[model samples]
Target: MRYRHILAACVCVTLATAWHSKATDDIAELPPMGELSRAIGPMVETMLNGGVAVGLAIEDVSGAGMYSHRADEPFVLASNTKLFTTAAAAVSLPPDYRWRTEARWEDGSLWIIGHGDATFHIIDGYSYPDHFLDQVAEALEARRIDAVDQLVIDARYFDAAYQHPDWPRNQLRRRYSAPVSGLPYARGLVRIRRGRSSVYSTTGDPIATVTNFLVRGLRKRGVKVERARRAGIREVQPPEFTSICRHECPWPLEKVLRETNAESDNYLAEHLFKTLGAEFHGRGSFDGAAEAVRVALDAAGASLDGFTQLDGSGLARAENGGNRASAATVTSLLRAMSKHPRGGPFLRSLAISGRRGTLAHRLDKGPMTGAIHAKTGWIRGSLALSGYMRRDEDRVVVFSILVNYNAPHTYDRRQVVLSFQEELLRAVWDHLDAVDTGWEPPPPALVQALEPGRPAN
Candidate 1:
């Protein structure tokens, strides 16, 4: 069921009362933020004293105000930026959207076109069958094409610029900063293990690597690839190329989103981001993707003010200003999403605290454990956690917390910032228990008197 539907009756009652209630009366009835502020104030102050900037915003799921401290100010989102990217994708792409790897026989060659499947193979602890290429091989063998004159890898679906320009150049080889390409094999990652040493490598040339991998797989399956060469990836459908087979990524878009947000998969996030651009804006470039996301969010009733769309993975930080998003902005976005037709799937895609994803080890033993489903992000001195929390069966809250530490002692300060964030979250969770709902059943006497045959007091 959509989350908004679950709460609609309660929300409608609240709204109905608001229509007749005085504005001042409504303001007076809101749950006091003082207790929560007081509980979390020292923790926030400790971070501030230690040279950290914290942005926090919290509200009931109905978009009712709860608390705010620097919540309107923008801070670097780190991987929290994935929330925006994935949300936009969930709205733009259909639920069945699957990255397609198409193979066709053309001019004495088998052409494999990559549509940039991020989950092409097992990576980041998610197990996918290692035999995607084997399936293609089997398809070719069944067609009695024992040998192909050449194997052509068409990877031009996305721009040739593999890596985002704003990413840290030094970290390009790491799995987290893997390049984005039209054809990403093993999520563009390769691992080499020696007798005593192991190393990880990101494919510098994704199309070439995938092409070589396919050749090796086909040969293993008794299909001969006499020659393999790279070809330009294009969106144009080749009418002359007869369809041989199509290999689909293991997971659909929903699972892709779950993995992206839960594990903070940079490659998947960027791949989907570019896909958004390619599908909606007619270009897979970064600018196109950013604009596509903006358009999607705007269509969803989200405010785009002060929001900057950089790389989909949130690895890029603004050079002149902070990558800003107000707490209200994020909460509103979440609210809109919860009410969206696809809200159930989209909300389920987030990481459940203490259970799985990036939050497996966090909030594991607290009152909030198992109640919070959020996206966690960390980049040097920046940290973010934002998502929904079921305070109880009857109460739900949406929150966004972003912390940026300016201190040079980042390693030591990170722990302090994280502690404060956890403590603050607990405080909010506790505060929800004390919140007063303006809705109460009418007095028993009044109800009885209103009945047709009841006597008045």
Candidate 2:
């Protein structure tokens, strides 16, 4: 009976959402770019010849232009998945929605629930919230609560699957690609500053150091919580005396999203993926998040029939433990995100070429510099890039390009294949100006390079 009731409630919710989606369907019309396609055809062929399966999408924000090729296919999005996670958060959570790192007073004791916010510590000038424990204590004192008896921590929001099976075990040692956690703090990492004590030493000694704001805050609060501990514990353990009273909470949503996108943090992606369901569906299960994404895709009229998803973060997957999404579905989601009320925030969070985020190193000093804001993804042999591209005449273009099977087996061959795919995209962008005029005669060097039977660089 309860199941039936839940089903009925879901149906009603779906209908209401469907009507809402239908109301927003009248986006601006897209313009045609046939000449642009022909110009980019050879370049794409070259990538195919080099053994890459590619998916690409280009749509003008003004509703004046659009194009797609294999945009419907499923390719591992890698960190590009963070775009969806962040967008979903903006839609589900309030624009100013804050993930509270709460300090609770129970029986004259203080308990804190770790809500995963990655930027709660100082690294390279970015510091955790100053005097966080003092603020919590101040809030408590304002309420006339005199003291805390003990400390209790609740991190039951997410499950025990700290690491996904699809990920390489060695990745756990790295900060950028640490395993996901429900109550992650300080980016779920500790920086190890290594130096040589003496040049004559026979071996290099490395020291691992941690910057735990939560511990520091608790100590200041007259509460004694140990510093630089591992992620989880089976039972609560407080200090012998209640002499300390400081604790640390996570960072703000905007700052968290910025770090996740700019650095392409893998753990952040996983945590955000699970957070979608926790916020909306009342659960943090990966399946719940997958269902939310599926429902959204269905409402958008995109098909996701054949792909297999192993994990929300694209981490390693069990036989059927993960959920799947495609380039087409992602593009549609991006379009919807663009139309969302807080879409501007999501768009700006992406890395811009030659300026900030992952794109800072690539496309530097290129025409696309400062014109492209996108997320990037990479795995053993796959590469995916998708987001909004600022184009000629102030046009905003949405695009997704995935390059899979770049090399049959060899590593160098794979790099060449990936480079070919990038060239294809560059060519497509270059040909847009040709739309207002006929194709220009090929210059001598250009003619030879693009001649029939000529090899693609």
Candidate 3:
């Protein structure tokens, strides 16, 4: 309740990160931000009795009039932590990076080396990885590779620390908390069928699972393997190995980001975090990944000053091991991404409120319907809605609403917190200081100001 940077609602936008639009960049000059502070100040204060640990921040691409309340204080980020991981990835890594898994014909043996491809599974009964393996099988068939001494599966690109240390032991078996690995299948989770429905659960060992999958794939295609096993990290293969086929996941990093942010897949999130570590720091462990995230975000203009990231996914408790960031810091990343030339994809990666992913059903009813594109985060005692709200190509804003509620974690309080978030967003739309298109209603204050001879300020 201590911070405020208010700006009146004025226009709509095509892209959420289209802040660099020169045509309407001067709209910030129309209204004083103080007007926004006065409008939403009381509305936000009344929620103290229902949910107290409220944090909020809203800003346009120019970083103007970001309504900030408790913006500087750190709050628990649940799945909202994916914002940091994905943003860092978007800015720091190669834009066209893909997850590569290769099969090689080595000295009298076949070898498969995996480099953190999470989409290595069949979808709608079509397996892309399997097809690539069939290509290898065809090459083997032509070479008269009747028998091989070993079919070695090597996932040494990532260290063997598949599970994060901070994850809850009780929840370890759940699909959401599935472990990360250098080589993953269906993002380290397996489908379990029950009656007419099914659920995903953690596969005990990702490497072994992938190994079995590849072994079956080859054997089914008539490539005989006498022994199949994992290759050691330090054991170097001879230089005589010929590249049979190098299969990369289709639009792999794009798919990973979508699954990580939109689907909120913790396994893929962790895979990305550790993979960043491997790519940037020469070590793929959790610490190395943490270092990589810090470096990446810092380079991209979002300082991790007060941010504490225990894991890539915000499954770890805030006070326990989960990541924490201030409302100001979350907005800092939003503002930074808005200016980043390549940040469009990261902004677009979020779920549309009324239409898609985790936020599909939440804000569908009112003016905010299909307007909010964001990541939703929820743990037992915390809830967050952070991302962009774009109505047209003129008025795009980035925001973060984080709340650490009182105990019991009841459904009613959850609704209260979310209601607060929607109202806060509605308030932002009200004050964004842009001209209306006549079909959609402007903010109440703007409507009043537009009446008769009143001037907008």
Candidate 4:
């Protein structure tokens, strides 16, 4: 059954109503941005005080546009870049695009070709397809193929830049840090579910195992487990494990995208990013994927102006270098996407704070609790939010806020900063005819960070 999250619907409505009053068209443009800044100066002051280096850009999709503060400057977009990736995929591929993971038998050997299907896994002895190995076994038995052979795995689609140098080294083994693959299964996760145990050991120990059971399940299909791991390319052997057939996957592409977007799964994001690269460029290297995304954006009529991309996944790696996106560019892309055929579904897939997916609990009791449907990105000191805001009369507004160099205090880093952001959004929500320019003093934490911290490199 499709997961119909109710909160998603409610939040969409709130945002739609919030911006309904103002002319969506540019004809009724508000006073100059300087005027708008003065109107909301108090809230902006609060954000700056809390040590948040923020850049926000909000627009009326229908008519006149107005912005306040640094809307033209570039800021680290973080995972908000996923919007570009998703938009590219939606436009380039047919609605039913499906990544193919294959197994081939030749001579006495078996070959697995990974087309970057990130969810390959078996849990508690149950493989993802549940019947995947059965298909392999059936094919082997039908051909009277049995005996021994080596398993050949191909990972040539992606280069060896597995870990990003800028990320904390300790995070490499995390699921979010899973390596991008031409054929990824289970997001390359070695599931490590742990629980308190009655075992005599005082310390809680983790029980970790690789799901998808690709190699192990193959052994069950009459193929001898001769070195049951990925080795060199083009493995060869005499006819041992014969008769291989393909089985349809359990999850479809839309289903996969829904889950990935809802929970902000980085592994899936990277896999999909590389998959697009491989599909379009014939290679899944980071550079290839990056190039493919740029090409896709250009094709979509997005200005490639002032855009730099080092990695498709945006995993904060040194190799990815760092890229920035101006508020204007982000909103322009959102506006374009909303007009696209699949825009509705794509927008609906993001998490709504205190409502669905990864954001179900955040801002649960706040003013905009059920009104913000956004993609949130956080890595160390960076925080970003981008998505559609639905106000009165079904008015739709798209906004992006990128905050870096968070303050050191608890309130500054958390509540105060979020409060300032929400306040700005509230003004947009109410469509207060014109912005309030009186600036609010920043939170103490933010004030300290801004004054004491070194300039961001």
Candidate 5:
């Protein structure tokens, strides 16, 4: 009996030793956070010299940390808010989701229902199948309905609010801040071109604008109107209508996301926000959309602490405590997005560094060029960048850098902030792999090359 007990004890000891060895190997595989902190500490201090509140976080693909500095503190995110909005959208909305517009003939009138197709206008580079209204007219012609007693616009898929209350009033006329409507035609803007100059204008009544444009389009396509004065925008019951034809937005949801993130298109972002509300909560109001976004984030397993999202476009600053997010939150979001089933489309939609979108002018010429895919955000007193950095095919790093300032928004200040951002990125990239096996800290000469005094190559 004593010999049998001894053999059993030996077996248990061997198993315990194997488990201990595996744990040690796992620890050794993690990045050297201590050394990374030492390397990036000085660069961060220099960059934050005059900046008010700055937050930064860099972690490996699995949320394992390489370095973190005040990453838990929240800072104004500006357009970086699009990252959250778009990611949630990608998960909630399918890849094939398309904005649809439909026409129906009911009670001697032609009723057109708009589903918030933001791309109903002639976007320069994109190919839309004929004009949307023209397609409707063609369908009418095919049915031999040359004349109609009246035209009704059913635009109630979204709430009646034309613009968000938090948006800047003065910028309302600009295309970026154009009023959003359930029925957006030409992205809710009218262009007036005189001589060699062209000016853009926004309408307080989007329904009226769409109605007028449709009247002209129908007339041009040989559809007659018996009483043009009877046309107006209103909500209609779906059961009372007989569907005639449907027109889909030219681009898919993924392409729309690409435009939103790459160009920082505020209009598209807000439209998508309301669309999410319409999809989940059965209401397209801002409140409903905000709630839907919150729910989606929670479902995606994202940490919501220290984050406040007021508007999808990030145009609205948080009131007592405005739109704010921590570097850790943003980095974790990136990590989560990467693991999502739709993560590929979401990540591919981001602006590639120095290649396209808003980043075309940034990180243009460097070893880091094309190595980062991120979103850039800038508003008065705030600047932020968050995304993934690919050191190679095997190593991916997620990072977020947010800076807030009290200085006036001026050209010089903008330049200073941009320079600091560039330098900081360069420093991170230079020392990223230094602690890896067989690698040493970056040499002094290489470190000096990233100084702000040295003009970019």
Candidate 6:
């Protein structure tokens, strides 16, 4: 009857803590980092031994920065780049935005046109694999149309770049690197679970596949589709077709964004990225998306002084000069999102530590379980964690801990660096989760002491 995904998200979110608006007063009450510093001295030393490049920043949403260690230096963001893209999209796109597609009948042809919707079967899925197509067939049946001479899958709505140029050509077939199209189903990937197993990944051209799938569906529904093919960008115009049925994504922008951040979905991220450009620049392409993102950040008052964006999914790596940003830039964006009208959903979208998404297993559970809501990113040489840590009930703090372990994979330092990050946050959450009674600005000695190889003073 409808499509259903066995692993659909079963999540609960109550949105973000209210924005902390008393900036000046909060600064006066800023917490001291002395305790956090002491707790991380050994951890940092060990990571340094393993050849790690650390960039950390922790800031009070209602106040100012509490501690910083080379926080201004830009580092490869990995999937952390998703934070910026999603944040920008939150601000620029309408709060209630939803993607839509239409099926049309014209000149004895059936045409399916898409406007950037990849959300299918991931949430509350339809029972049938392609319920939307079935619905189209039923609609045609209701209209007493028995057959169509041709079926066309039109994906020209989005540019045919298909894949990001900066992405490694070898990894194009990986599920994480699934190609994007104007109209996508199941994030443009077909699951290959075997004998009750849960894992799956294989790539196929979505437009071509859907066209054929729909043809079979129509044939099964007592309609004959003589031919099926993908439509080019300039193939069909408004006057050339008559709308049959239109379908809108069941989820709104907020919910889609939750999936974007919670699942770290590259396909959703890229489509939304291009949608931004299409909305602002009248066409969906990498360049347009980049410019639109900048505008959104500018509108949010988030600074990207040293940030460089190449693609939406942060799939770009150091070898090809991927997305880069400073810890300060990350915190700045988080802080702005806290006060934004859409901040609640934005915060709620982040993956929870020891609870769900990428961090469901990390942070070691216990009091820290479900308490830390953040996004985790990892690639060959880089790892990033950025988001909010609830101070109590109505308050929160923002932080970004980015590490680069590219020196040598001979003995992967992932465990060591990961331990450093976990213990550091554990200390912040358990011991120094509040402001210092009497605090002062970070001194020159402290800043100098934190310079990578240098010992803490």
TM-score of each: 0.83, 0.69, 0.82, 0.75, 0.83, 0.82
Off by over 4 Å in 3: 1-35, 191-200, 318-321, 434-457
Clashing pairs in 1: 156-233
What is every candidate's alpha-carbon RMSD to the true fold? 12.3, 15.1, 10.8, 12.6, 15.2, 12.3
Give the better candidate number (2 or 6) by TM-score: 6
What's the TM for model 6?
A: 0.82
User: Model 3 residue 447 lDDT?
Assistant: 22
User: Which lDDT tens digits does candidate 3 get at residues 1-457?
Assistant: 2122111111111112222232232232223346676666665554442324567777664566456666777888989999998987887778789888888887778888888876677766888777878888888888888677898888888889777767777888787888788777766777789999998888888888887877787788877778888888898976898988887877646566877887787877887888888899998887888889889889888857689887788887734446899888888887777667767667667777766678777667676676777899998778998987775554666788887754565555566666667777777787766422222332333222111211111
User: Against the true structure, whose lDDT is highest?
Assistant: 5
lDDT of 5 by residue, 1-457 (tens): 2222332333222322212433333333333455565656655544443333467887776766777777887889999999988988998998899998888887768887788888877778653424666667777778777888888777787888877777777877877777677777878888789899999888778888888987877887788876543233353354677788888888899899989998999989988988998899888887888888889987887887888877778888755566788999998888777666666667777887777787777887878777778899998878898887776655677889887765556555555566656666777788776745332232232222112222222
Clashes of 3: 20
Global CA lDDT computed for model 3: 0.72
lDDT of 1 by residue, 1-457 (tens): 1212322322221322212333333233333457775676655544444445667778776677677666766778889889889999888898999998888886678888888787777756754434566666777777777898988888777788788777777888888988888877877877779889988888788777777778887888888888998874534545798877787877888888988988898888999999998899988888888889999988987766678868888887757553457666777788777666655556777776677687777777766666777888888657888988775555677888887754453344555556666777778877765655342332232222112211112
Candidate that beats the other on TM-score, 1 or 3, i.e. the better one: 1
Clashes per candidate, residues 3 or more apart or on different chains: 1, 29, 20, 49, 2, 8
Candidate 2 per-residue C-alpha lDDT over 1-457 given as tens digits, one digit per residue, 9 for 90 to 100: 2222332333222223212332222111223357776655545444443335566666554333356656666676666667666766656666666655555554465555555444444556745555465677676667676444444555546655555556666665655455455555555554454584322111111111122455556567655543333324455534442333344334456666766776777666677767666666666666676666556544444445544544555555333333335666666666666655555556667776677777776555567666666787776556778876555433455677776652334545444544554565566567665544322332232212111121112
- Estimate the lDDT of model 2: 0.54
Cα lDDT over the full model 4: 0.58
Q: Indicate whether candidate 2 or candidate 3 has the larger lDDT.
A: 3
Give candidate 3's error at residue 419 in angstroms: 1.6
**Which parts of model 4 are misplaced by more than 4 Å?**
1-39, 122-126, 191-213, 227-243, 247-249, 317-321, 363-370, 406-412, 432-457
Better of 1 and 4 by TM-score: 1
Q: Lowest-scoring 10 consecutive residues by lDDT in candidate 2?
A: 200-209
